[model samples]
Target: MRREGSKAFYIHTFGCQMNQADSAIITSLLQREGYHPAENENDAGIILLNTCAVRENAVDRIEHYLQHLQGMKKRDKGLIVGVAGCVPQFQREEMFTMSPAIDFLAGPDTYRTLPLVIEQARAGIRLASLEFNAAETYEGIDPVREGLISAVVPVMRGCNNMCAFCVVPFTRGRERSHPFKSVIVEVQKLVASGYREITLIGQNVNSYSDPEDGHNFADLLDAVSSEAPMARIRFTTSHPKDISEALVRTIAERRNICNHIHLPVQSGSSRMLDLMNRGHTIEEYREKIALIRSVIPGVALSTDIIAGFCGEQEEDHQATLELLSAVRFDSAFMFFYSERPGTLAARTLEDDIPEAVKKRRLQEIIDLQNSISDKHYQDTVGTVVEVLAESESRRSSEQLMGRTDTNRVVVFEREHYQAGDRLNVLISSATSATLIGRPEHGVVQH
Candidate 1:
């Protein structure tokens, strides 16, 4: 059903891949209801903010945006403003009190009900936020928009692991996997719609389990790969402890599965891991890495690292450096730990790490990782690799940028190529974060 005079809308998304996928679903739903996507906020009748609650900085930014929106709403009286995703899930009533400009507030799981909520809000009714549901799945709604080659499909929602420093468990609630048939159906549709790559997203993707048929994440991956052999398969944010041997084997067997894994090891010290409630030791993490490498030769490894947690000592910092050197991740997302309200760490541990010390340690990790990343790229020089052309290079129009199967960014000079085209490139040069290459003679079939 389409509204006769529905106006254009725009959604500004923040946070992880899950949030991005959620925004896509929202976009699809809005489009189905006759809302056209606007080019910018200034041109839209409705403005939606899909926010993040991962850090306090994110909250501050949202508040600043809300104040700006208040002024926008005052100028345009018919503007419909809404807040969705994790932030609204946590600060429901508080957000309404903070910004009277927000006409609608919807939680992560409540997106399916957004059309009804927005309709009520447009009728000049005060809208209340809906609580998050663990079992909610937006599987049947077709996403109206997607990236050129890569698309994110959220296979599950929320988190079961209560890592002490994280508010995810409290904000998102217990984990629940989406039905396997639904996931496969979505993947097939995406592949048929010209999508080449799919990354299965969740809080802890590897922990996904379908209770109906007793199928786990590995089984799900196999099913998807078998059904959609034309598309590249990948998944993210794997917990170190849950990465099974079968998962590694599946990657090795599948020709279209990407050769990259992002397993987060927040800390290196065993004591720190225990304090963080990570449920895996440093040795266990190393063994998992070794197993992954053994199964998929030359696979690129990446990780998330946090510097200066509550009680991190000099020795603990040294151990972290040692672990980095040993693992030699091709890339890392590094951050200085920030305590969040309602988290176990905030309540139990003292955030005693000096800011200067934390910054210094983070820099050290960055430098080391930079060197490691450079080495990893340098090793690939003179090798021919396949890349999926994404877009033109930021620096020069003459160059095109894409990513290899290992997920390393490659910039090359190529003509007569489009965004979704796959090409083989002969590597000529390497840097810390990029590979310089030229188009080779052949194309690799998917």
Candidate 2:
């Protein structure tokens, strides 16, 4: 039977993978309340923007999108428009003033109240809530995982670190880990449902420790991987300071754990690291990188880099560039330092670097990383790697696309192969962004 709904909703999401996971839970919440998803905003009875406030421009972008929604509301006076996630998680009152079109608001921790908020909004009551639940990790909520082949399971919520430039501590509240058994149960269900991949997500995944049993991050990872040995296990957003050798060894030893880690080195200069309170030094990060390489010889390394941070000098930018060249990271997510309201950087330091300087530094970082990535991709040619077939290649129907354990996109000939099939493919050629390959042995397992 239908979970809910002749009524429909449209969840427009922004920000990180964590936000994507949150949006999924919100979908489940609305579905359980008897609402279905609309094909688009025009068809939906409600429009909710799962927002981000990591950068000032992200908020600007959401506000700009809200302007268009005003016309949608004009067509249906009863249409509910709401804002959720980190953008309003800490600034709910400001959000109410930012856009008159919004009829309601919610925070990262207050999604359980969404149905009631909607009901009240429809009755001519505009309300907003940002109640932080000490234990809310949306555990009881069964999320719509979007598909069966891969699922995102949030094992923890919030962060304890108050990085000088970050708003996460303020927006997401204090660090709290989810119950270990609940996480294990969730992963077991996904595997039973034919999920071949599970990505354990969190604000700081390495910091996760079970609330009841006192199991640490590595313990949880071991449990999940043991439960589903054939499934590709992956995790995200590891802070450098918390990355343990045990975690690195687990990735090396576990047959299922994908050998890719997202270690964010916001800046390579120790001076900047101290200012950001990232809790690690450049030399220490380099040592960790060395340890990771020693353990997982072929690990694909990715990272996040911020350019022109507060009080950044030309030398600091040079230092970042030098690290990019030295590490030769396979890929990176690069951004210009944008002061978020309520963050330490905004309250105390200057966004002292000129906008032009930030842009220049960011572009230089991108160009360097791309060249390095090209070099790395070229070196992988002729290697036989196993990739889990995912979808029809966007370029052609005759080609199938999937990702290597290192997380590189590999496109291969589609010869009776189907999605979820793992195939051994030999790299034939490379583009700047993708690797083209041919299947070594067709249809190994689907």
Among all candidates shown, the one with the greatest lDDT: 2
The digit string of per-residue lDDT tens for model 2 on 370-437 reads 99999999998988889998889998999999999899999999988888988899999997678999
Model 2 alpha-carbon drift over 4 Å, by segment: 1-6
Q: How does residue 167 of candidate 2 score in lDDT?
A: 94
Error of 1 at 305 (Å): 0.4
**Which 10 successive residues of model 2 have the least lDDT summed?**
1-10
**RMSD of each predicted structure:** 2.3, 2.4
User: How do the predictions measure up, each by TM-score?
Assistant: 0.96, 0.96
What lDDT score is found at residue 38 in candidate 2? 82
Candidate 2 achieves a global lDDT of 0.88
* True lDDT of residue 325, candidate 2: 92
Please identify model 1 stretches exceeding 4 Å from their true place: 1-6
List the pairs of residues colliding in candidate 2: 4-34, 5-34
Q: Write the per-residue lDDT of candidate 1 for residues 291-403, one digit (tens) a residue.
A: 99999998888999999999999899899999999999989999999888878998899999999999999999899989999999999999999998888899989899999
